[model samples]
Target: MQLDTIKSPGGSGSEELVPSRYAVRVGDIEVLVVSDGVLPLPTQMLGHNADPAVRSAWLKEMFLPQKAFDWALNAVLVRSGDKTILIDAGLGSDPDLHLPRAGQLINRLQATGIDLTSVTDVVLTHMHMDHVGGLLVEGVKDRLRPDLQIHVAAAEVKFWEAPDFSHTAMPPGFPDALRAAAKQFTKVYHNHLRQFDEEHEVAPGVVVRRTGGHTPGHSVVRVASGGEALTFAGDAVFAVGFEQPDWYNGFEHDPEEAARVRIRLLRELAGTGEMLVATHLPFPSVGHVAVDGDHFRWVPVFWDY
Candidate 1:
């Protein structure tokens, strides 16, 4: 409940939280990449069989650790003139995910000099726990929900915020933990969510693109400016899965749709060369998807901020 100072295993500084910054101008608009925290994951869970995969050779070639994975929870801040928007809230106070850093969006938000209340909107790509977890301030309520309009895909509304989701779902392999991870998504923020249709505009310079499958209402945001574009691909594709974008996550409510969406998104990314940002990609989750023979590769857009 206190400001956690989970140092990035090897970061040097007294700053408990260090953010990855991506500064780009979109037709005169400024966009910044703010991250919540990184999840120290095991690489094998991300590989074809959780590490030591075929690329295990390449990882060794680069002299990187083969032991595990550290995924970043990225939240983008778009500031055009005086309008400010957050792409997705981070994992807030979820104990089970062991996500002390996972929900640091609020702090990252502060680091970016943006106030949560003044945030014109909090655009959610899906209802996944990590993505929607930071919707609320850790232990505060009225202080956090008053002025924000949460934008979620309509289908996402019926799914996560619906009774069926809580009812039909089985006892999560780990309930209390999963629930802790998911509870941050509980509030409706005014009991009114701005659900959108396909190709909706989240804000000026921010366009919503439907790329469902991961979550029924899963969507991505296309931000274009100064002849440059970035797509907050959301969870349409994950780390290891991006290598095999065709494979769906274990919990896709609709596996077939997830696969279809994966292929379609990969095709678009490959064709247009738009940068992809994943909420759950390897830390700093920004990358370019390129065609490699019969598969796709994630060329991580590395950063130093």
Candidate 2:
């Protein structure tokens, strides 16, 4: 069935029965997790370093397909004090990639009553096309505020200048597409780029910190307010990461370092019991980490209606 063409009972035009956005209140700060649709990727992207048989076993354990599966793409919208901050822009339109199901962030944001111009600041976890492409969408730049500041790690900006894909194991065409998208994004938004060394606060209680794992400038954003907190881990952790913390994801530039970073972040989250949300996790991926023997576990929070 053509799900996208399905209309609501009231005939309110094409609308998805499945939710695309979920809201969670971190004390006084308001955070919304928006889905950018899903990307169908090969299962090997889960962990290229893992034994093929072992990886297949894990997929079977999770009741997932062994060949390919849909990976969730999520972005966050944070309202703290007077600022409306976007944590990551979702995958924008990439006809070359033929990922038609993804890149729904713009339309979904509008459906949520969020105006592009209202965003005061943007905090990028990294310059991956999926994380920065939404801003590069046609006419997206024109709608955004001229003075909008995009916060990113300085190291990330430098790394992209001569990005090395020696360590990555992505599907064909991904590397080239990523390079082109990053270059175009940098050229178009260079003036608004706000490079930070280690960490920077984009708004009250919203801080983005460099972790340097999946990418040289890879980072995570932590939102804390009124004694509650949540971390938006962009590409650091994945669905299979908990069970196989050391497994090398196909997108990591430095697989070993990425594994180290993942373990460290997981340990921290498990210890603190803070909410965790990751870029490629399931939609509205709000959850907590738990120590599971030698590795870790994902304990998704119970939905609140």
Candidate 3:
């Protein structure tokens, strides 16, 4: 395949298949952006800021009524040649998060005509269950099948698999069920795979680059073919501050390191004018980053269908 980009559907922030199903293609690669679901955030999740009343009013002005912030989880699926690579699973919403859409990743996969049995690789950007929630099904507690090469950063694996990790101390932002589900896969994933290097190749041109910061060993997957490239940025730069291009992620283990990597990543993306795919960049989250004056601005490219 020379190179092809197909737009699917339903993604609000990216470009893909349809208004309901999200998918895009570049040359021999077919990347599907599927939504786990959406959530509403309160001022606390926004960050410790100014007056609550003032902020709440400001949020209302911005159309964020009900004093909530809404977010969506879009998992990426890259199919090239005979391999199917899943990048981060949607948040395991279920009873853990008291939400129901978290486990729709597999459903979305099947809807895209990609079979879970054929997915040879399950790549994790970090230890956050939302990013790796779909590795196992909702009810198949012990009947897990479809052998896979689960790739993770050694540091991330160690962090999640750490025996001393306080499960009860998991951030309130994440669902409790998600944490429990993660524990289940601890032994299983350890038996199958471990951490990856700074630059590890998964598929032909698909490479996992160490852009650690969000987590100690967090990484971003870069897909390049026929001179066309796209990066799957997981939680590095959320939408609000990403437009600023300089604001540090509140959740990053090391904000300074995260900012530095974001700068380098943006500079590279802008230089190449390659497509950028992000987990939190909005639906159909495919776009380009450009240097604007002294700052960088993310440009969402629309598919002309």
For model 1 the local lDDT of residue 158 reads 67
- What 10-residue stretch in candidate 3 is worst by lDDT? 1-10
**Lowest summed-lDDT stretch of 10 residues in model 1?**
1-10
| lDDT, each prediction | 0.64, 0.92, 0.66
lDDT of 1 by residue, 56-162 (tens): 76457556568665676787877655567778877776554455656777766555455566677778887766677676555534445465667777777666543
Task: Please provide, for model 2 over 26-127, each residue's C-alpha lDDT reduced to its tens digit, 9 standing for 90 to 100.
Answer: 988888888999999999999999999999999999999989999999999998988989999999998999999999999888766678888999999999
TM-score of every candidate relative to the true structure = 0.78, 0.96, 0.81
Q: Best-fitting candidate, measured by lDDT? A: 2
Q: Score candidate 3 by lDDT.
A: 0.66
Best of the two (2, 3) by TM-score: 2
Better of 1 and 2 by lDDT: 2
Candidate 3 off by > 4 Å: 1-18, 43-66, 139-146, 162-181, 246-250
- Report how far residue 22 has shifted in candidate 2, in Å: 0.4
Q: Give the Cα error of residue 93 in candidate 2, in Å.
A: 0.7
